[model samples]
Target: MAEVMADNRVAGAKGDGRFEPIEDSQARMLADLYERHYEPIFRYCVHRLFDRTLAEDVVGAVFLDAARTIRNFRGSEEDEYRRWLYAIATNHIATHIRTSLRRRVLLQQAAEAGRLGPHDEPARTDGPEWPQVWRAIQTLGRNEQTILTLRFFENLDFASISAIVGKRETAVRTMLCRSLKKLRTQLKSVFDGDR
Candidate 1:
């Protein structure tokens, strides 16, 4: 169609002389994927970083990186693309955290601006346990935190998680079980007290 052609997203024509679908083209596919997944990715970053402005910045950076690297992307399926995006996001967050001084400075600024902490905003109306759970998740290591976030928050299966985390599916499953067990133990006192 004219609209698809205008976007400069068509990779090439098929042997049948028909143009490939816009979604099949690397550039256009990323455009479509950005529309579909940006909000969820932002939400994940928000929960991961606990800072709205920083999360927005990170989301922009993630998509920008995706745009720059899309030509090299080999994902043939939508889910694969999703995993790839999350992997990129996870790596970015890790790199951000590794800069201890910069992270501390940012956290200080956020705190001074009254933008830090999960309690600054109500995350859900469904339960009061949301803040408590966030606190518990924050106490976890990077991989454990990422695994829990992808598994419970994103509701991704082990296979997708394995792809995102660069681990075997069985390893992902085992890690998830261990992470859940640790989270339970970490939160046991609060849960027991609530009972």
Candidate 2:
């Protein structure tokens, strides 16, 4: 934690590029940044991964990476910093999903479907196990999932999502609409199976 702070100190030291130890004020600022952004970042991870335990792990990694790089971070204010953090969280979750959890998610979805039969929507939609909906979400590409999580679950605007995803606002909006339509089509059977 101490190492995370202290990269920048005093006035013209930056031009000389000499490293100075962090003072109390800088430490406090770092603490404030973490306090301000930690929960939202964690929530993003939880929403994307659908596992609190895994989310916690991902959050830890994100903040650690942020801490290490915060000195170099160009963003002076919270909004830019927050966007950078989201970008980091996005990469971490995508990596986690790609490397470790893709097969598990597919298997879990299959098991849930097989066990629940064709009629059940979900036993508990609030928790990580929103069987039908989550299964449908799992079918989407990584960018679509990120867009949906940022837009609906995180309640972020399209422009913000575009910044995080490196796309234009229009592209973000278009992708979101297409993703929602796909999800609706996939879940149509689950919602209207009996009808």
Candidate 3:
């Protein structure tokens, strides 16, 4: 009888492993992670790319990458997973920017073959100050823009931004301050021109 009971318990365990019902635990875990991080990630991407579609694409890719690699994640008390996720996002954004710039260059070359006119002027938007601010942001160097995005849009601390960008915390802070000053100067020029 004892032998039969032991066999039954083993079989039950095997069946549980093989054909277990879907549990809400994993869903809750994923939801919690997404809820906590999605907005900041999306904002970071949007600020970097200045396009909603590209931001959405990058954010989706980041989450997908996280899901794929989650199995290897070891449980930790520290928020290591968030840091890892941000690192992945930073890499993805960099790759996307490179590929997009290459494509833009190719498109420009192709269009030049037909002797087309210069590219049309950027569209005017409704916002009074935001468009000017955004245009000034575009003038910043890539690293400056990245530092600004991570610092302001993502609301990440210098340490977190440093971790993402593989720089020292002090360096990141200095970069952010310098970038902000540059942006301010650019915006001033824009405003001066508008007057």
Per-residue C-alpha lDDT of model 3 across residues 1-195, encoded as one tens digit per residue: 112232233212343355433344544576778899898788777666655677899999999988877767775633676777788888898899788886534434543343322236453433234434555666677777777877777777787778777889888888888888887687665546653
Q: What is the per-residue lDDT of model 2 for residues 1-195, given as tens digits with 9 covering 90 to 100?
A: 124424444433444577555465655766897999899999898777766778899999998998888778888876788889999999999899879876556655664674432344545543333545666787888999999989998898877899899999998889999998898788776555532
Candidate whose TM-score is highest: 2
- Tens-place lDDT per residue, model 1, 6-63, is 5454556777788765554566677899999999899888777766787898899999
What value of lDDT does candidate 1 attain over all alpha carbons?
0.78
Inter-residue clash pairs, candidate 1 = none
Worst 10 residues of 2 by lDDT: 1-10
The window of 10 residues in a row where model 3 has the poorest summed lDDT is 1-10
Off by over 4 Å in 1: 1-24, 100-129, 193-195
Q: Residue pairs in steric clash, candidate 3?
A: none
Model 3 stretches astray by more than 4 angstroms? 1-20, 23-28, 74-78, 102-128, 190-195
User: What TM-score would you give candidate 1 relative to the actual structure?
Assistant: 0.74
Evaluated against the true structure, the overall lDDT of model 2 is 0.78
The segments of candidate 2 whose C-alpha lies over 4 angstroms from its true place after superposition are 1-24, 110-129, 189-195
